[model samples]
Target: MSTSKLFDSYKLGPITLSNRTVMAPLTRNRAVAGFVPNPLSVEYYAQRASAGLLITEASQISQQGQGYQDTPGIYTQEQVAGWKKVTDAVHAKGGHIFIQLWHVGRISHSSLQPNGGKPVAPSAIAAKGKTYVNNGFADVSEPRALELSEIPGLIEDYRVAAKNAIAAGFDGVEIHAANGYLLEQFARDSTNKRTDEYGGSIENRARLILEVTKAVVKEIGAERTGIRISPVTPANDCGPDSDPKKLFDYIVDGLSAEKLVYLHVVEGATGGPRDVAPFDYAELRKRFKGTYIGNNGYDLALANKALAADEADLIAFGKPFIANPDLVARLKAGAELNKPDQATFYGGGVKGYTDYPTLAEVKQAAE
Candidate 1:
C-alpha cells in the first residue's frame, strides 16, 4: 500500500517537484473577452495547487493560433498579466506551473481565425470534422498551406510565447504538439501533403516541431522546457501517421538532443477517433532519456503499475485532477474519488470546477 514513488520529489530541469503527479492541461474555454484568463481560472488553479506540477490549459501563442471561443491566449500583454495572477497563486501554494503553448492550425474555422483569414496548415486540406465556433460545432473550413517562408515566423512565435511564460512567473512551458494541433498537423502525414522541406520525409515533417522546441529552449533554458506529444491520438482533424514508430523515434531523438526538462507522451487514444496505434510505449520511454510523463485514461492503479514497471517517470492525470484537486493525497490515502461532471467541464461556473469534495470533505461526510 506504499505510494512512495508517487510521493517522491523529482527534479525537472532546475526546479524540483514535491511529487510525481502532474495536473494535465485541460481545455475549459472559460476565459474572458479577448481570451484573457479570468479570476475564476485563478481560483481553479489555486485550488488544485497541491499537485506536484500543474500545466495550464492549451493557450494560443497568437491570434491565428486560436480555434475555440474563450480559451486563453499568451501573446498579449493583458493575457500575460492575467496568467501572472494564476502563476502567482500556484507559487504561493508551493506548486510549480507550466503554461501549455498551442496553435489549432487547420482545425480552426474562419470565424475563429483572426481577421477572417484562412486557417493555415502544412497542406491546403481541410479537416474532416467540425470546429467549435461562436454558435457551436460547425463544419471546418479549408485551410491554406503555409509557405516555407512562414515556418520560421511560426517558430519564433513559440519562442516569444515561452519567454512570455517565464515572464508570467511560470517555471516552464509545454509545447502543445498533441491532439491534432498545429505541431501534430505537421507530424502526421495525412494533414501534411506538401512536397516542400516540411513534408514527405519524416525528418522534414518533424522540422517545425524540432525548430520550435529548440527556439523555445534557446529563449528559456532547455531544462525548463517540455513538449507534449500524442503519437497515437487522432483528435481534431489529424489522420493516422503512416509510420508512427519511425516518425516518433525521429522526433524523440531530435528532442532528446535538446535535453529538455521532460517529454509528456499521450500513450493511447482516450476518446479520439483513431484506434490506438500499434507500438511499444516502453520503447518510447527508453528512447527519450529524460523524465517521461505518461498520460491518457490512466487510473490510480494503472498509473502506479506504470511507475512500478519503470514505464514512466511521472503520471499526468486529466479528468481525475479536475474532480479531485487533492488527487495526490487521495491516491496516497487510498480514498475514493469524486466523479467529474462532464456537463460542467467546459465554459461553466465554479460548481464542477472547484466544488469537488476532497478527502477531508468525504471523511467529514462519513462522520
Candidate 2:
C-alpha cells in the first residue's frame, strides 16, 4: 500500500501493467533437451508473477542464433509448447509476460552452433570473450561474416520467432538488440568491419537492427513489439563506438519512426557501473515516443527517483527479481531481500532457480 509512483499502474502500448516494475530478461542457461525451456521455468516465472511485466530469458530464434549452452529457443513446436506453459502460468496470476528474442552472433562456441559450424556475425573478427558451452566457459569461436544474402534469412528468423512467441501465448516479444548480441554486433562499428551495405556509415551499421525491428513489428503489431538496446556497454568485447551519442540517437530515431511499444535502455554497462561512459540517455528518451523502460543497477530509490523525474515509464530490475520472487511485494513492504546464489546462476537445477523464499514465507518461518 505504498503511495510511490513505482507502485502505480502503467499503460504500456495496448496493455496495462499492474505496477511499474519490470522483471528484466535474465539468462539462466538452464534449458532442457531440444533447447526447450526447462520445465522448472514455468514455476520459476510463475513465482515472480507479481512483477508488472516479466521478460523471459533471451531465447534464441534458431539454432544458429544460440550462444550460451542450455538457453531456450523459440523456433520449434516443442519449444513453443514449453513457453506456453510459462505464459499460461503467469497469466493465471494476472501478470503480463514478454519473451526476449535473441541471436548471439559471435558470442558463441562452435559446439553450440549448427553442425559444429562457425558462429556468424556482422564480420569475421573474433570477439575477445567466452561463452558457456559443454558445461564450461570457452573462448568464443571465430565467426564468419554473414553474407548479404543471409541478411534476409536472419530477419526472417526474427519474424518467425515473433510469430512463435505469440503462438506460445506471450503478451509480446522484446527484440534483444542489447548487450553486444547479434543485432548489437551489427549496430556497433567496432565489431562490424563489413564494407558492404550493412557496414561503415552509422545508417549502414544501423540497418540490420532497424530491418529486424521492422520485420518483427510487421509480423506482430507494433503495439506488441518492443526492443532492448545497450548503447555503450562493452559486454562481450563490443568496443566503444566512436560517437555513441550520435549512433544511438540515430538508432533511436529510427526505432521511434517504427513506433515500437517500448524502448528498454540499459543505462551504462550491462552489469557494471552506471557512469561507465557519458552518453545522454535523455536524448534517446526524447527520440522514442513510446514507453521507456530503464534498466541496470536500479534499486528501489533509483526506481522511485526515475519515475518521479519522468525519466522512465517503467523500471526493469534484474538480479533483485532472481532471489526475490515476490519483489514488488517486498519493495512495497520495504522488507529485506533474499540474496541470489552466484554459484548456481548460469546453469542449474531448482535450488538457485526457484527455491528462494519469499518475505511472507520467511515471516511465517520466524513466527
Candidate 3:
C-alpha cells in the first residue's frame, strides 16, 4: 500500500511521464471573451504541474463546436496564442500537457453558437436538458442534423485543431470523443439516426471517430495523439445503444489500428445516474492495447489497485485535481486531500482555482 504501482513511470508515445497520475480535463469557464485563455488559466495549470500528464479542459475546435460561453478555443490565432501562455507555464514546471479538442454537438444553445444558429448534431434531436451559457443556464435548442457532405468539414476542424495545439506548444492532443460530445453522438445509435455510411451498424456508427482520428494522426504523427471514449456514459444528453459492448468493441478495434498514444476511458459517471449501470472496466483495459487511462471516482487506493491489477496504465483524477494543485505529491505521500468547492467549480476567479495549498504549506501550518 505504501509503494503503489501507480507511482511508476510509463511511456506515452514519444513522452515519458513521471508517474501514472493524470489530471483529467475540467472546464472552469474562466476563459476571456472570445474564448481565449488568460493569465489566470496559466497560473491555474502551472500550479498543478506535478501531475504526470495534464489534459487541458475541453477546447472548441471551431466556432460551431462551441457549446458554452468562455470555454477556450483552438482554431483561431488569438486563442492559440492565448493557450501558448498556459503550455509555456506548465512546461516551465517540467510538466507535459495535452490539449483536448472538443465539439459539443447537440449539447449547446444558440447563444453559444455562431450567428445565433441552432446547435449541430448527428441528428436534429434536442438535448433534454439545459446548457450553461454566458448569462446563465438556458434550455438546449433543437440541433440541426448535419448533412452527409458536411461531415468532412467537421473532421477537418479536429485536424486543424490538433495542428493548432502543436503550434500552441502542447506536447500532444487528445480527441475529446467521450462524454456525449459530437463523436460520441455519432458512436451511439440513439443519437445518430442516419442511414448513410456513417450510421446504423457498429462499424458505420464508429466511422466518424475513425476518420477524425486518422486525419489527426495524419496531421500530427500518431505518437503525439490520444483519444478518449465513454462507452456507456449518457452525459450531456447522450442516448445509449441497445448493445454498448458491441458498439465500443468495434470503435476500440478501429482506433487500435491507428496505433495512437493512449486511450482515456470514462467507465461511467463517478456518482451520477450513469453509475447505476453495469460496466466492465477490466474488459475495456484488455481491449485497448495502448496506454489506458481510467477515469471517474478513482482515489489513491483504487488507482493503485487498477494499476496493479492491470485494469489501467494510468488514472485520471478530475475534481480532486481541481482543489489539490499538487495532486501527485499528495497521492504519493498519502496526505489528506483538499475538498473541492462545487460552488466555485464552473465559473470563477482565484477562489477555488489556484488558491489551494500544497502539503508543504499544511505541514508548515502545524509547526
Candidate 4:
C-alpha cells in the first residue's frame, strides 16, 4: 500500500495536524511518589512527538478516580506542574498532546481508593480481573453503588480536572469513557443495573457520560473536548451489550449535541479480534459529523484504507508506539520496526520505554 494517505495533514479542532496518526493512550505505571508524570514520562512522550497527536495514559481525574498503581492524577497542583514539563517538551518538538481524563470505577481495589472506601460504580458488582497495585496484581473488589448526592461532585471532579489539563499546557482533553472503565460501566447495560436517573435505559445509562462531557466542555471550550467510547468492547471484564449497534448509535447521536472535537471509538474488542461484534463502523461514523478516530488493531495498510474510504479521520496505535517512537517516519520510509518488550511495559526505567532506536539510529548501527 502507498503510505501517502497516512501522511496527509488534517485539522483537529483549533490545531492543524501534520498527519492523521495518533499515539494511543498507554498505561505505563511510571510516576513520581505523588502520582505525577515524572521526568522519564516527559522524555518518553517527547521522543514520540512526531505523531500527529499524543494522548497521555488514562490519568485519574481525582484520587477517587484511580484504579491502578502509580497512575498519574490531574487534580493536584503538583501533578499539573509535573505534566506541564511534558506538554512543554512535546511542544518544543512541534507535537500536540491531549490529556486523557479517566476514572476506573469498580475496577479498583480498597488500597487504591481514598479513606479505604470501597470502589464506586453504578452497581455493586465485582469485575472479573485483577489490578496491579503497589507491585503485585490483586483481585478487583466489589464496589459500592454511588450515592445520588455524590453525582454532582463526580461531575465537578471532571470539571476541575479539565481546567487542570489546560493549566498543564495541554492543547486539549480526551474524556476516557471506553474500555469498560467508569464511563463504560455506566454506559453498558450489564454493568449498570441501577434504577435511578443515571441507570436503566440507554438514556439513563448515558447520563453520567453526557454530564461529564458537558462539564468538561464548559470548563474547556467544546472545540477542545473529545470523548472515547467502545460500543461492544468487553475489556476489563465488561459483558456484551444486548444490541450494540442500537446502543452505540444512540450514544453517538447523543454525543453529537455536545459539539465535541471528536468521538474516538474502539471498533470491537480491545487488543483482541477486530470482528468481535456485528456492529457497522460506517453506521457509527455517520451518526457523528465530527472527526472519528478508529482504534484497536490497525496497521499501516488498514490505517490508509480507513482514511481513503472516509471511514475514519484518524487512527490510534497503542502497542506499536511502545517500541517505535519514529513510527510516522518509518511508515513513510518503509523501514523496519523494532519489536517491543512487554515485560518492561509497566513500572520500568528507560529500557523499553524510551530506549527504542529510531530507523536512522538502527541503520547507522548496522553500518
Candidate 5:
C-alpha cells in the first residue's frame, strides 16, 4: 500500500474512508444549555465533513466527566437528540464520525462537576492548570482519590456513554485515554499513589484504561471502538510519566489483545516539543499491531512521510482543520494554508469556528 497521498481511500474496519486525512477530536466548547450539541455545532462539523474520519470533540460520559464550560455530553436524552442532529448532518455530507468519550479527572473545577463535587481521580493530586468556565479560566479543584469500590461505577460510565453514542447515531466511538484526563491519570504514576490493584506497577496503573476499553468494547463491538493515548504528553499537567516507554509499551501490548479498531497516539507531548521525552513512536507502534492514527503537529509533508514509511495508517490533523475546512483538497493541491486565529479558537460565535472558507473560496478570493 503506497500511502504517501492523502486522497487515497482506505478501508477502516466496517467503513471505507474517502481519504486518509482524519479530523482529530477538538474541543470547540460550543454546546448549548443542558450540554447539548447545538445547531451551530451541526454547521461547524458539516463544514469539515470531507475528512476520512471526523472525531467529535471529547463528549463527557457523565456530568462528572465534564471539565470545561459548555462542552457537550452524551449522558442525557436531550444530549443524545442534539448529537443525532450533528451526526446526521455529517452523514448527509458523506462522512464518518466518532464521538470521543472523555473524563477530565483532576483537571476540572468544582463548578464543572455535578453538585459541585470535587473531581475524582486515581489519586487526590490536583492538576497544575486552569479549566475554562463561563468565559474565564478557574483554578482546578483538588480531586478525591477513587475508592476501590468506585472503579466499577466509573467503568460503567464509559459503557453507558458508548451506548449513548450509538443511540446518537455516531458510526463509532473513541475512548479519550490521552492528554491528562481521567484515564491518563490512572495510567500515569506521577499523580496516582494508590497501593492497590489499580496502581503501583505499570500494569496496575493501566488497569482502569484497559478495563474501560473492555467495557466499552463489550457495549459497542471492538471494531467500533478506538482509543487515544498520550504516552508522554504533559499537557493539562498529568504527564511526563515516570517510565513512559515501559508504561505505554505495556498499554500497547495489552491493547493488542482487545482487537480495537485503531489506537490514536500523540508521538510526544500533545502539540509540544517532539523531543520533550525519550518515548519512541516506532516502539509503541510495533507493540500495538493494529490501525494507528498518529497525531500532534502533523503537516502535509510529515503526514506523507509517516504514511509512506508505514508509521501511521491515518494522520490526524487538529489546529489545521480549524482554519481550513477543505483540508483534504488543500493538501492534495499543495495550496497555501490559512492561518488559524487563536483568539477565537476556544469560545466564540462561529467567527473562527465555521467562518473558514473552502479551497474554492480561497481560490476565488485570490482571483
Candidate 6:
C-alpha cells in the first residue's frame, strides 16, 4: 500500500489515467507487412497496462512520413485494424493509451520513401545520419524542401491520422513534434533553411507545428490532442536551435493557445544527459497551461523531486517501461528494476519485447 502522487489517478482531458506514470513512446521497428503493428504488439503493450498512460511507438501518418524499416503507419484501414487490438487489450486491463503520430521527414532513405523519391523536409538539406531501411542502415537520402502548396495536405494528413486513432480505440493522440523528426526539423533553424513563410523566424518555424496541432485538435477535441516537444535535444542531426528558449517559448505559447490536453517535453537531449543544454524547462512549463510531462533520464528519486517541486504534472519513463511492465508497482515498492536487453531492443520478435518478468514472477520463480 504505497502512496505517491506518481501512483495517483489523473484526469487528462476526457479520460482518467490510472496513475501519473506514462510509458513514453519507443520505436521497436517490428511492424509486419504493410507497416502494420506486429501481432505481438498487442501483447507487448497489454503487459504494461499498469502505467497511468502509454504512448505507443511513433507511427507514421503516411507512407512518405516513414523514416525507418518496419515501423507502423496509421494511414490505412489495415493499420488501424492492427492497432485496434492493441488498444482493446490495454483497455481490457483498465488502462488508457495514446498513439504518437509521426513523420520522419528528411531522416529517411530513398528506399523508404514512396516511389523511391527523396524525403521531404523544411529545407533541402541531408541530415548527417543514417536511417534503418532495407533491413540495414544507410545514409539518409537528401531531402527536397516541402513546397508551400504541399503544406495544407501535410496538415490534413495529421487531422486524418488523429481521426483514425480514435477509430482504432485510442483514448487520445500525441502529435510527434519532438526528437529530430519532421515537425522538429521545421522548428529548428539548424535544419530549416527555407526563407518561405515556414522559415526565417521563430514564429515562422513554429507555424507548421502549430497548424498541425490545431488541425489535430480540431479533428479530435483539444483534450484528446497532446503534443511532444524537445527544445534543445540535438537528436537526428537537428544541431542546436540558435535560441532554444525563445523558440520553444513561442512554440509552447502556441500549443497552449490550442488548449491541448498535455505537453510532453523531453527535458534535455533525448536518451542522453538531462543537463546537455542551458535552457530553462521551467520556462516552457510556465508557458503551457496543460499537463506537462517531463521526460528523459528520470529515475525514481528525480521523479519524486520534480513532482514535489511542481516542475511537471506527470513523468514519462522510456527505457524503464521497456523492461518493467509493472513499472508502477516496482517504483512504488522501491524494488529493483529489470535491466533491458540492449541487443533485443530494436527489430526484435519476443525475447526482449514481452519477456521481461515482473517482481511477482521473479519471486515465484525463486520460491
lDDT of each: 0.88, 0.94, 0.88, 0.91, 0.90, 0.94
How close to the true structure is residue 107 of candidate 4, measured as C-alpha lDDT? 91
Off by over 4 Å in 6: none
User: How high is the lDDT of residue 198 in model 2?
Assistant: 99
RMSD of 5: 1.7
Assess every candidate by TM-score. Answer: 0.96, 0.99, 0.97, 0.98, 0.97, 0.99
Q: CA RMSD for every model?
A: 1.6, 0.7, 1.4, 1.0, 1.7, 0.9
Question: 1 or 6: which has the higher TM-score?
Answer: 6
In the predicted model 2, the residue pairs found to clash are none
**Poorest 10 consecutive residues by lDDT, candidate 4:** 1-10
lDDT of 3 by residue, 11-99 (tens): 88888898889999999988887789967999999999888999999999998998887899999999999999999999999899999
Give candidate 2's whole-model lDDT: 0.94
Clashing pairs in 5: none
Superior by TM-score: candidate 4 or candidate 5: 4
Q: What is the C-alpha lDDT profile of model 4 across 1-367, one tens digit per residue?
A: 3456788888998999989899999999988889989789889999999999999999999999999998999999999999999999999999999999999999999998898889999999899999999799999988999998999999999999999999999999999999999998988889999999998888888889989998999889989999998888889998987777777888888789888999988888988888997779899888898899999999988898898899999999999999999999988887777889999988878888989999989889999
Give a tens-digit lDDT track for model 1, residues 324-361: 98888888888788889998887867889878988898
lDDT of 6 at 262: 97
- lDDT tens digits, residues 170-205, model 2? 999999999998899999888999898999999999
Give the Å error, residue 226, model 5: 0.3
Please tell me which predicted candidate would have the highest lDDT against the true structure.
2
> In model 3, which regions exceed 4 Å deviation?
270-275
- Report the error of model 4 at residue 112, Å: 0.8
